[model samples]
Target: MFRRRPARELSADDLLTTLGRLTAQARAGAELQRARVELAEALQREMLPAALPGVPGVRAAAAYAPARNGLDIGGDWYDGFPLPGGRLAFCIGDVQGHDVEAAAFMGQIRMGLRAVAGGGADPGVVLARANELLLSVDSPLFATCTFLTFDPVAWEVVAARAGHPPGVWATADGRCGIAEENGGAPLGVLPGETYPVTYWRLAPRGAFALLTDGVVEGPSFPIEAGLAEAAKRVRDRAPTGDPADVAAAVMDVAEFTGHTDDAAVVVLCYDRADRDNG
Candidate 1:
């Protein structure tokens, strides 16, 4: 998408003809691609939580960007919902492939994970069940997901990572770090083993970012370098209007710099006043 630079000045007739053809071709291609993107994005959007559950003290926003120039769909997804006992569930995941089938499998995984986690399972238990569910189905697809439970009252979180990228945490005090969990192999590849959970406390008004590997792993750049660059940008960028905007901007930057993978992210920002004032 970024390869075609804007046309420059040329002699009048030739320029007009060339520009006209190019414009028509670009317009046609863009329209066709846009239609496909819209369809894929619609399908992908179905995987996200339709409405972020109303946590008394929290307001959240989220965004997803499929690959810009590819097959118009991807296998990354994010979801947030209310957990029992007034906690909130936040998660991001990705199936290995980027086709429609992968996307369909991705939707299944998203719903399955939420269902398993919604049943009061701990992060580890949730991942174990998810793995089992995927394996028993006889499908060859594999997915990586991270499950996070946020406690608004305590500003603490319990997270489980299953072959997914580590989450990013940006604190109210301006400190940021990757939330590392004991991630197991991707689901559907292994069965009968328990995934491990990690615990951490978010400083008041902290922002937690959960992302797919596409945010870091692409064909061009090393994953570590991409991650480092992304972390720096997320930390340095001024706090935006909403969590979704923050997440989208990060992905935008990554894609702008030529990362072609389908990137997806979910950002959770907690407000201290909401907990304290209550």
Candidate 2:
């Protein structure tokens, strides 16, 4: 038989000691969660480019916002680099999580993108290689992405999508529309997945831009409506020929719509003529 211990009135010093121990434990737990978030945020900042490179006849800019919610950071990323023979490449993607593990894989996918794209592979092939690379890692996480290569001389862009949201295109004449992206399974979902390519040309003074899903979707907000609103914002702002403004215009959607996800966007506004903004 177990005997119930009698409850004794606690001395003031004993109560104070018990309270301090509980307080310390609670503080330690909170600090631990904050530390994880800080580390992931640092990793994200380190992975992103210090500055977007300049492309002939195109002014480019990108923006990133972390939900930084909960105990981890999310996996929204974008990249740009100049290719051989006056071509430029850019992409945006979201891996399937909000944890340090997601950010680590995000870095891996990014490196693969840079390496394969640096070889000047076709945009479709670039994503295919990336798919292979991700599968090789054998991580449970999958990612959605849009990859595109542009030639200013020809005013052409070849893009491929891996279950990502279609990008926005704004013509110089003040028309804005979403790209009807040829979709494939998200990376790491299928081995040897071939992402079909889509082609579009942005005439001088037009704009090509990609945004992660976070910009458009949130609780009580339909993604369709968010996308339509983004199109309107781009149309109203793209003609200004300022890539920064265009990026801001898109990011504004996330802010006003109360999205709870991390967001990223890349805006490349084709200039009427090439100028050095590098």
Candidate 3:
């Protein structure tokens, strides 16, 4: 109870101990930050498939490149899910940012697409519903996208674009061109925007590619030139190349562009079911 013991004098050893503790804390904090970044990147990467879904007469392949100029993950995503009547819905989009928040928004948008697309609905309606879902979320981030339903049985395509670059297509005879950008505003931007439906026919051994702007746009390279070059490369590979190889060809367009953003490509190649059987 007594007189308080004299305050412990600040000795060199005591100072050293305190400094060591602070250093350790700082190191631990840095490590924690690194871990969090890694986790976010992994989750974002996992959201997009490493191997796209496969169906009879339709082979899908994808290639992804994260942003080379930043450590944080960017928000480019693509997926293929089964639809009713042996059809499949494929989407590729770029959410606006290179951070964890963008990735989270991307996840929500993808889930909404899958949920609304279950009935094999028209592509325009599907996009409109998805836009509502995105708008309802408490986020400022918006996305540009192309959504489409492909019927492997009919070799038909019904697609809708939302303020995004038009997709590219190549027939078996080496004819290739880009789609018309008849798109509405990007998702989560304007309320009640309408996405127009566009029809396309896929010939046997033909291919369609959905890609983000990163694959064809750069500071020094114009998208127009890049797209033309991409079409040529894709047409060169679409006839006999595997979907993976063809997807790479699409990505290769950025080589001259020197693109620094994240890039993603999903290629859908169509072949007659009877081709292998015959």
Candidate 3: Cα lDDT at 231 = 83
Candidate 3 matches the true fold with a TM-score of 0.86
Q: lDDT, candidate 3, residue 91?
A: 97
Q: What is the Å distance of residue 155 in model 1 from its true position?
A: 2.0
lDDT of 3 by residue, 133-218 (tens): 89887589999989998876667889999988888888779899988758899999988899999988767678889989999899
TM-score of each: 0.80, 0.91, 0.86
> What value of lDDT does candidate 3 attain over all alpha carbons?
0.85
Model 1: how far residue 12 lies from native, Å = 38
Question: How well is each residue in 144-248 modelled by candidate 1, as lDDT tens digits?
Answer: 888888888777889988888887767566676666667888889987977888888666565777777777766776766766656665665425426766676
| By lDDT: ranked, best first | 2, 3, 1
Model 1: CA > 4 A from native? 1-42, 237-241
Give me the overall lDDT of model 2: 0.86
Question: Which parts of model 3 are misplaced by more than 4 Å?
Answer: 1-33, 273-278
Candidate 2 regions exceeding 4 Å error are 1-15, 68-71, 272-278
Q: Distance from true position, residue 231, model 3, in Å?
A: 0.7
Please identify which of the two predictions, 1 or 3, would achieve the higher lDDT against the true structure. 3
